[model samples]
Target: MKLKQLILFCILIHIVSFTNALLRRCFQCRSRGELGSCKDPFRFNATEVEDEHGLATTPCASGWCGKVIEGGGTYSADDFDMAIQRMCVQRGPDDNEDRCAYTVYNSRKVFMCFCQGDLCNAGSSFTASKSMFVILTSLLYLYSRWNQY
Candidate 1:
């Protein structure tokens, strides 16, 4: 009947809207000029506040989940410092995408990455880049060897 069809359509719409309302999540933590899981070579240990994989996450209802790394100071000396922050960022329109941006101010260097989807702001992106670098380097080495013959 028409009534049944209308009700079914309304139910479907409600389900889709509900799914869309579900917010994305990302690791939420911070560390400043000190050593911790939130710092370089980030390795978060298992804790009750973290997920099963030991990642501390928070809901990102607006904008995108973001990870920020800031470091500065003389690398050859003991004054080197670093900071890291992971959280939901609500900024301009461009903050809604999956991209990494780097900026430098004075002696400080900052690297910030924004990403959509649940838990997409994790450190996997760094690992992926490293893997790609290895693959590309190997390919270039092989190409040079082949052309040498």
Candidate 2:
């Protein structure tokens, strides 16, 4: 009777641990940033202005051209424009010295955006590892139980 109870308890513990791990993975994947962090790159301030030459073809011209602040990563006209539309000042355009000009802001906020992107990528790998761990653990547990019987 004691052996039977012990087996049941072990099984229950394994189930609980596996379930908790799965829940964590699900929550991490659904969260905004990745791995329990904020993914937003910038706090945009919108400004309305009228273009005198009617040459405001890009949205960033009059709406919100991300405040070039210190600490933010480098910025190119293209990626900067896209980030502006997304209300995020995180993304920067590809580096090109000859054609497009780029500026690197010395701001923590800008750096944070780059850091967040890195974290997001790391989180994806972490989640994958968690999945594999769970599968292997479950298989090992089952195999052990069968061998014991």
Candidate 3:
């Protein structure tokens, strides 16, 4: 009976460790800016009217930018937009012509839309924060289970 229990405990520890490693890898992938670059010069399709003088204002597009892996991956820009929307209210004027720009950083990978921009941005920070949360949660769960043993 003791041997059986030991085996079970060992198995549980292995499982937890494996899961933790996997989660950490995923977190690193998202946080390290390894995936891509920011799409630069993200322009608005239409000119906007100024609030007071009716002058043409510099058009801007409200969108999240992040890095994506090369040779295709499961990540989607729409999913990133949804996640961002969940976190914060949309910025800028509500214009249909406004666009969100995404840049894939890998030299080998080609993104269908959005021009290349600097990788430094709010989205990268958000990604790192989220990944840290996931890693911490996984660790907490493992710690709890270990204590129960």
Candidate 4:
């Protein structure tokens, strides 16, 4: 490839590699366990903590993890427990028209979402932070042009 093309390709590769979503085995926990009280938040597997802490949520295999917090009770009625659940999530394949239905709002006050970045679903939004991406790309462009001659 020509010098310009080669430089562009290198920059693209750098951005793509760094910006690519990270894969991770995140810590999964929830206020309501599969069983009952005495569940440990730090217990990620059977080997870690006692079963009394309920059970460790399944690890994220589809490339996402998340936390759901809902109020007004499970029924969305007044005066009830607010449920908080955190665990792995799969947004769905990109081949589909909608890569991910990140959020779904039902008639109840329930809200759900998913993320792609590693541990991004840890009670935060699904999308990865991009502020640095813009600045870095701009800088790369300037640097490449200056060194072109």
Candidate 5:
């Protein structure tokens, strides 16, 4: 019946939407200037880099994008090095999440910030909204599928 077909179609659409959101991964990179969009030759395998900085790849499943800053001071000495890390965050800017905690060690204040879009944490300002991109892409995909049938 048409009712059964409609239910199945609705389920299929939901599955596609959920899958797209889950698969939306952020690029793992450190930047001195500003982080670019996670396009190009990079694909999401979620690989961690082995280094003293202890940076890791992150997925934006929970909520927003995050940036971790360590050693926000002078870098004149040979041992002085600044590290910037980007990851998928679970909470927003005002949320009291575990990952958003700030701690200081050895006169270094470890700071964190959150943004609500893909690659939006590249800098202080968000270039584009990830949700917009997702909605647009999804619409196009659904439109193409409709045309096919």
Candidate 6:
């Protein structure tokens, strides 16, 4: 009976771990000075961004990825200032559900986009190591469960 209970507990733990692995992950980066991969015409590579830039991806509890462009020019202007930011945005229930939006904040022109995809804030894709870990852990637990039977 204890063995059966143990198996059930292991299965529950695996389910919870795997669910956490499904959280939306976004490339957490920002433009610096006049050079950065996070700027317009964003360029992203899983290894390069993680290794060369030394930036880590962030998991969003809200399941939303966001890209923010802030500048001093008008929305119609061709020239602007400041930096771009890629981050996880927590959206409230009453907030706008639109994919993109334009607004003015503190006299700065801000263009924001919210997406429901992993790594959607950047035009790139990456594999989650946590998911792989969960898979391996579950397999190990199953192996032990069977060996006892």
* Cα lDDT listed for each candidate: 0.60, 0.32, 0.32, 0.51, 0.53, 0.67
Best by lDDT: 6
**Root-mean-square deviation of each candidate, in angstroms?**
14.1, 16.6, 17.9, 8.0, 7.6, 6.4
Report the lDDT tens digits of candidate 3 across residue range 11-120: 66786566434321110012112212222222111122223231122212333222232333366533332111111113422453323445433354333222111211
What local lDDT does model 4 show for residue 11? 78
Model 6 TM: 0.56
Model 1 C-alpha lDDT per residue in residues 34-99, reported as the tens digit of each score? 544566555553244454432477777773777887765456343135677777876524534467
Give the per-residue lDDT of model 6 (tens digit) for 42-147: 7664456656473558878877777877763546344336678888877722464536778664487688787755566775433344455676688678767877
Off by over 4 Å in 6: 1-20, 32-34, 72-80, 92-98, 105-107, 124-149
Q: Clashing residue pairs, candidate 5?
A: none
lDDT of 5 by residue, 1-149 (tens): 56655765786688667755664444466644233323222222333333324334456775477666675455545322545666775556555332445766348687776555444554523234455467657766875676576
lDDT of candidate 4 over 1-149, digit per residue (tens): 37766887787678766655344444465564333431223334334634545435344667665556555344655423555565676654355221323244445455554555555444333334453467477868877686766
lDDT of 2 by residue, 1-149 (tens): 57866776687679767644433211111112222121234211112112222112122211112222222234643332222111222333444111222344443233211111211222233333465578668767876786687
Better of 1 and 5 by TM-score: 1
Q: Candidate 1: which pairs clash? A: none
TM-score of 3: 0.21
Candidate 2 displacement at residue 34 in angstroms: 16
TM-score of each: 0.52, 0.24, 0.21, 0.46, 0.41, 0.56
Q: In candidate 4, where is summed lDDT lowest over 10 consecutive residues?
A: 37-46
In angstroms, the error of model 2 at 132 is 0.8
How would the candidate models be sorted by lDDT, starting from the highest? 6, 1, 5, 4, 3, 2
- Please give the distance, in angstroms, between residue 108's alpha carbon in candidate 1 and its true position after superposition: 5.7
Question: Model 2 segments beyond 4 Å from truth?
Answer: 1-38, 41-71, 74-125
